[model samples]
Structures are given as C-alpha cells and as structure tokens.
Target: MTDRFRELVVNDSLVDIQYKTDPPTETVSPRVTYDRDDVPHVYCMKKTIPLSAFMERYARGEQRMWLAAYRPSNGRQTTITFAKHDRLTFGKRFIDAVAAERAHLFAPAQDSDGDASAPPPISSKKTAEVSSKAAKKISLEELELSLALQREIGRLGEDAAYRHEYVRLHALDCPNPAEHIVRISEDDVGAGYDMRSTFAGQTRYIEVKASTTRMDSFYISENERDTLAKVGQEAFIYLCRVDRDAPKNSAVVREIRDPMNPESGILLEAVAYKAKLSN
Candidate 1:
C-alpha cells in the first residue's frame, strides 16, 4: 500500500485524498491543507495534500513500513491481510473474503465424484464443504472474544441492511438506483449515518442498529444523535435482528423515521459524562 502511495506521489503532481483507499496524506509528511472548496460531509472534496513536498519524507518512511510487515511475519502474528479479520470473525463475512484462498492452500485434494472441478467464487457453503475435510484447522484460542463476536453479528446486520436498501430501491424502479442509495458506513466512518437513501424523494440519512438479541436496544454515539437532530424527519434507524447461525439470511425488520420527534416515541439516555480536572 505504501509503495502504491509512493508511485502516486512520484507520478502525479497533486493527488486528491478523499477515500480510505487513498494514501494517508495527512500523516504529517507534507504541506497538507484541509483544502476544501465545499462544505464537509456532503461528499465534496475535503482535504488535499501536496505530495511533492512530502515525497522525500514519505520515501524515507519505507523502512518503517517494511519493519512493520517483517515483524508480524517473524513473530507469528496475523498478516496485514488477515488482520482485517477484525470483526466478529465468528466464521462469517471476514472469513468469506479469504475463505477460498485459505481452502485452496490448505484443503486436501477432494474425491473424484465429479467434484474436483473449479471452485466457485468463495461462498460459505463451498469453502466449508471443501475445507471441512481437512483436520481441525482453527482452535478456540484462535477465535475472538464473545463481545467481538457480537460486534460481528452487528456488522452482519449492517451488511444485510445495506444490500436491502440497494435492492429495494432498484426493485421499486427508482430512476437512479446507484445515486438514490449508498452504503456510507464503509467509506465514511464518522459520518454518523450508515446509509443515504431517498424517502418520498427527500434525502434520508439512516443509522442502522443490528443486534443478535434485541433490536430495541443499542448505543447511540454523539455524532449519530447530532445527525438525527440536524437531518430532522428524514433521519431513520433500521433495526436488523440478526441470526447468529445464519447471518446472510438476516434482514432489516424495522425502520424508525425521525425518532428525534417527540411524536415518534423514542428515548435517548446519556451513558457517560466527561469531566475536566480542576486547574
């Protein structure tokens, strides 16, 4: 990734840093400016870093990047690729991506029964059916904590809801399905909203709450509430009740719009307070 960034800096005069995949230009290397010509949060240009200034600095940091990669390999830690399995990894979405790769490498040659054909594009059933034949590959300690599993379930809910919105709008013949709905949670972590859709043609900002146990309860961050207040009635919360055993089948069961409105009958509780030390 750092190498790719170096290529961009060396080749391009000025590069735009909008998405996460873009190089981390704001890493105190360049004469970076929060060079925004438009307002923040509406998907306009936010920050532009002058990479020419940091070309030397960034090039020098290649040593640090190599050290990071080398140490993890030598210490028997997860690789940078597998480290992204940060979610519940309760053997779900995170595994789904690398499942085929893992199976191809470790899985034994299967029986001829006309099944030794080319594999499908890494689905759960195929990965499991093929890999299950091997010896016990993963142990209990290799798994994440219960809380992390719960978070993974929550992510499953988010994934389900994201797909639903895109499909629902497309099925309903929304003029532009691509423009009408977007999964903001993937790209914009601090946007306070998970999705952007249309409600009666008005812009709808949606915050999704997916729980394995209860749909009625989930923590709301300060940014989420602020978005609800600012967006007014167009703001909504999609409750996705996920089934741990079957995450892919889960779907958004409820949609609450404008919870900030007293008539909507939703409540917010303050969980913690910050304090400043006496001067």
Candidate 2:
C-alpha cells in the first residue's frame, strides 16, 4: 500500500481505511489525523493495501479494523469490517466481508428511468412495513411456493458453480475430470462441503453458496464451520451469484481459496444452537 499521508502518527489503535484501486491525483501525501474516541479511530486510508499485509498486521495485535474499497468515479464504496469475533475466525470472516462488499459493488445496475424490466428499490422503512404485512397477507400456499422457488434458485446456483469448477479443472489438464470433481453434496449431505477436487497437487474441499439478489450476508451451517476448522487451508468456497430473471448460465462465480484461520478476519456470531430438555 502506498503511504499517502505525509505526517503519519502511529496510534495505539488502528483506523478503518478505504482502499482505492485507482491512481492518486495528488503526488504529495496528506497528513494523518487522530481522533479521541475509545473505539478504533476512523481514518479512511486512501492507499491500496494488500489483503495479506492487512491480515498480518491484524494478527500481530495491531487492531480490529474495517476496510472499504472506494470507486470515486462511480461513487460506490464496498466495506469489510472485522470485529473481535471476526479476528477469532479470520479466514471465514474476512472472505465473507469481502464477498459481501463485492456483492454490493457488483450488484446489477438499476434503470435510470421508470422501467418495467426491474422492480423499484425499496427504502428500509418501506421494506420493514412490507415484511410485517407480508406475513399477515400471504397465504400458506403462496409462502410454500415462495420457499420452493428460493430452494430452486439455490440449487441452480450450486449446479452452475459445479459446472464452472469442472470446466476449470478440465482446462487445467487434471486427469479424469468427471471422477475428479465429485459433488459431495449428493453423496454425503452431512459432509459440510459441496464438492472435492485436486488442484496443484493438493486436495480441495469446496463449499458452494448461491445468492439470487445482491447480498452482503449469507447463512453458514455449524457443520460447515466445523469442516472449516478441521480442514483449515484445504477448505475452499465458491460463491455463485445469479439473477433470478436472467439465464442460469449468466451466474458469476467468486472463488475463495483456503478460507479458514484466525488471521482471516472473519467474525463468528452465535445465532443458533441445539438445546436439551431437562426432566
């Protein structure tokens, strides 16, 4: 990362910086500013720091931080924040943060005018209101149909990713492509992975996920987390994003390699668990 700040001050805490890929206009670096807040001070570092460097710094007890990629021309900023929990499971948290940020960044463009091709965007208030009313108004049949459609979309995404991996492996001259790229999801539902393959003489266990619309967050099962813990660097993730209205082939795959470690900057939240009843 290029140091843009001239008068750099090293604080005990780290700041949340914005990584811009574009070239800087001013050759002279700006002075670093310090804030008095107890929480990690916010400083939008305008330099492009390598993800590895950031991970190293974060792991060395530097600070829990957030990174935002800024595209000035488009006025779009994609942010990745790693908290205390994230630092504990760095790999998964970091990948998730970047994936979410990229998802928003790569979201399909909206129509400038009032066009019928896409639905209008909804505000937070409007969305909440609609969600509350949807449960009361939606019939049981409609709910089931909606759920079924969602499942189908997810299935399509997984299939698209599997096909992508197969083609990629075949192109790489991996022997017995069909047998090599096995869909573990079909064979063992509790395996915590969707597929397995050999890449660069190492076995890769992959977990496939799909998102119909742009999303910064997705679900991960406990089994998947356990698999990640057990496999470590051998685990991989393939995120397939497809537009529900577009052709299935139009899906885009984002590959995450060896996404498990304390240095990965992933935050783990306790959302669900099993409980036993006492007599």
Candidate 3:
C-alpha cells in the first residue's frame, strides 16, 4: 500500500473509535411553539377538549367545571355564572363561587326567591330548581317569590337560554339532535319535567336540575312528586352539579333513571299530613 493510503486508513480508524466512546448530549420533550411578529412563543402540548365532554367526565357527571380565561391580546374575557347564595352579597358570592371550594364555604344554588322583580319561582313542575324554604304558604305552591333566596342557580332569567341549550345537548345524542328533544319548560311550566326526549319509540320525562354544590339534597315540588308517581318507570332526572373549579376529568351528565324508585339509589321522603285547625 502507498504511504498516503495507509495514513488515510489510520485516520478513519481513529474517528470510528472516537464515535464509539462518546455519549450523546441533548434530550428534547414534545412542545408546541408559535412564531408571530418576529417573536417566539412556546407552550406545552395540551389537548383542547370540548366543554361538554369536560362536564360529563368531571365529578361523576353530576356537576360542571368552569374556567374563565382572559386574553388581553384579543380583548376577550371569559366569564362564568351560577346562582348566588343568600348569605353572601353579589360580589362576595361571585368571588366565592370562583374561588377554591372549601367544605364550610360550600353552598348549593339557593331556592327561587332572590330576584327583585321575582321573575318567577324556579319550583313549578317544568322549572328545574326548588322553591325558597323561606317562602311560606298554606300549600307548597303558594310560596312568595319576593322573599329573595338569592340562590346560585335556576334563575330562569337570561340564564335560562344557557341552561336550555346545555340540557338539550346533554339529554341525548342523535343525527338530528334538536329534533328529538322537546323543551317542555319553555312552553309549559306545569309539565312536571323540563325537557322530553322521544327516541326509537321510547320517551323520557327529564327533569333538569343545575346544582352548584356537591350535596345530593333537593326538594321535590308537589307536581314533580305527582309526576314521579304517575310515570313510575319513565321518570328521569338530570342533576347537573356545577363547580367553577371542577377537575378536568369530572362528569357532566349524571342520569337518575326511575329517580323515586328504591332501586334507583335516590332516597325519597314521603309524608302525608292531615292537620285540622281547632279553635
């Protein structure tokens, strides 16, 4: 072999040895980045899940999780809403509802009675909320709405549209979703259920209750109880438990089928009273 060729072979061998002994230097994880206006923006990879799915998977499908995102660059603010508590004022209630929920600070949406004009008690058969405990009358239906319970849900005012849409989407899924679900509350407050879903020759009388607290406590109006008795197996309730800080994987839709039945896992208290006034 020529001297120059031998020298080249020796150099190649040395380079191979160097590669076998050296260790790699850098490791990189997956990330998302955007460059705009000659500026670099980097973010960790995150899945943009739908709000409905977020609600369904959160807290066993009993409550909702809310997030308020403020994007100053886009001049957009995301606001959340629930009914207010009676003990707390408007500002305090707003802050508390959005704050980290503590056991003591936890309060479910109040019964219907807080509005100034008393839009209407949220306790009718078609109404999705309960009546104010404070409202008094000879019978359950005679309670006064002006007592102002200042609850955190079932306002049935501007928020009614939101609740209706939320319940409608959550009630059922079909190719023609809107067509199968009828909003009974909008047309008839005495129907004993908020929405009715008719699918595949089966019908469901659905009572939609939007709850802000984690408690399972609720008051059933006379009409609702009567309907539960009349439609034994067809009775269904969608108890939506809403929380501003519900976990990302919590449940949004919890269906209570045959709600009044013992096998349904719901506890119902019954009391038949005959009180006669004696002078």
Candidate 4:
C-alpha cells in the first residue's frame, strides 16, 4: 500500500467499498471487516488476495485483488491486496506500482528562477493608444438619440396641466416642488421601450407605452430589460393612451408595476416608434 492510502486510513477518510468478478466464478473469496463504534458505520473489504502468486495461482485464491472502503463523513478509499504466493511477481515493481497509484498525492516544488520574480511594465504610448481607441468606439448616433430624449423629457416641465396634476398627487409626500422634475419622452430608461416621468428623483424609471387605440400589451427593448435588472425594485412601467385624433386634454394615463413580466402581455401592443436625434 502507498503512503497516501496509509495516511487516509490514519485520518479516517475511508468511505465505501465495491467488488466485482472479472469472469463469473463460483469460488468464495476472503473478506476484511472494518467497523468503528465511534463513527456509527460498518464496512467490509471482500474478495481480495495478497500480492504474491497473483497471476499463476488465480484458481487457488492467489489473484491480484483490490478492496475499497468508505466513511460516511469523508468519502472512498481503495487498498490493493497482494496474494502470499505472488511475492516473486512484484519483486522490484512494488515501489513503481505504489508510486503510479499515489501520483495524485505528490507534486514537485516550483523552481526559484529570477525570470518569474518580476512582470514587464506597460509603456505610456501604448496606454494612450488604448484610451484613444476606446473613445473612438462610442456610437455617435446612440449618443445623439439619448440626448434628444433627455431634451424632450425636459420640455414636459413646461406643460401646465401635467405639472399641476403631478404636483397635486406628489406634493403631499414631497414638500419641495422644485426637487420634482417632470420629464416626458419616448426614452428607454429602465424596462420599457418608452418612459415618461414627473419626478426623476422620487419616482423611479417609468416606462411609457403610448397608443392611439386601446391595446393589451407593450414592448420592451434589450437595453431596457438590462436596466430593469440593474434598477431592480426602482423600476416601473406607465401606459399612456393618447388619442392623437381626439381632444389633446383627454389623454389617458395608466400605471403598471413590473410590466416586463412575460405574463403582463405588454409585448403584444408594441409599435414601431423609432426616431433619430437631429442637430
């Protein structure tokens, strides 16, 4: 047996044992029982023989054999048994066999070469080149669209009716009206395709789905989905039903929590509202 197996036995790491015959035979094999009263488990190693005469005395119970033991708390441990008659079979190869079986327990030490002591440094020119490339990679069209959405949201503050209604609803909770900023636009802020907001600070990211007709669902973009996950509970969805053909003052607004949920059925009512920012 290798030192690894000995160490495992001493440390009480043995878990379980299993045995199977190579070719079906009727001969009864010897068994080793291991029962520890302190550990509350009983195990056995059966059908194993000594290393001596393992090849020639197969019929006489001298075949090379292995035994596996297990501990309930640890895992499994294997010990090879040699038959008494097989002593000459392993004359010099015993050490080699032990080493081969226990290879996983041993590892060579690292060399103390000076080459591994220090790492190479980066140049200033290389650092500047990387920064320049990163700056150039930003999409101008995306930036312009974001800026346009932001500006449109800013214009909603000038709408007197929207401002008064927002103030009447939110003023009781928020004493400072100046802190509340109303923003309305087809802006992809959190979890919906378009969002409108009265107070960006007190109110979380509000996704707005606007339609001229009554609809059952709305759409959310990939970026909006990611933003919703990032924002978590601080995200909301608002559906604005605006009759562009009717009186402008009669627009209807409805609020829904977690509109991105698949069960919400908002995706069915999605319409193409794509627009680019212009100078």
Which candidate achieves the best TM-score against the true structure?
Answer: 1
Candidate 1 per-residue lDDT over residues 137-188, each given as its tens digit: 3322223333456666767888888877878787887767667777888899
Best-first order by lDDT:
2, 1, 3, 4
lDDT of each: 0.52, 0.53, 0.42, 0.37
Error of 2 at 196 (Å): 1.1
Off-target runs (Cα >4 Å) in candidate 4 are: 1-168, 171-173, 176-178, 182-202, 245-247, 262-279
Give residue 165's lDDT in candidate 1 (0 to 100).
84
Instruction: Per model, state how many residue pairs clash.
Output: 0, 7, 25, 20
TM-score of each: 0.49, 0.47, 0.40, 0.30
Cα RMSD for candidates in order: 18.7, 20.6, 23.8, 26.9
The residue-level lDDT of candidate 2 at 42 comes to 27
Kindly state the number of residue pairs that clash in model 4: 20
Clashes of 1: 0
Q: Write the per-residue lDDT of candidate 3 for residues 1-279, one digit (tens) a residue.
A: 111112111212211111111122121111112234322121211333332222222212122222232232453433221121121222223223222222112334455785333232333432233347654212121111112222434433214433444455556554565677778877898988877766767777877665556646776777987797688778887766554233222233467888878888877776445689996
**lDDT accuracy of residue 117 in candidate 1:** 42
Off by over 4 Å in 3: 1-152, 155-173, 244-253, 270-279
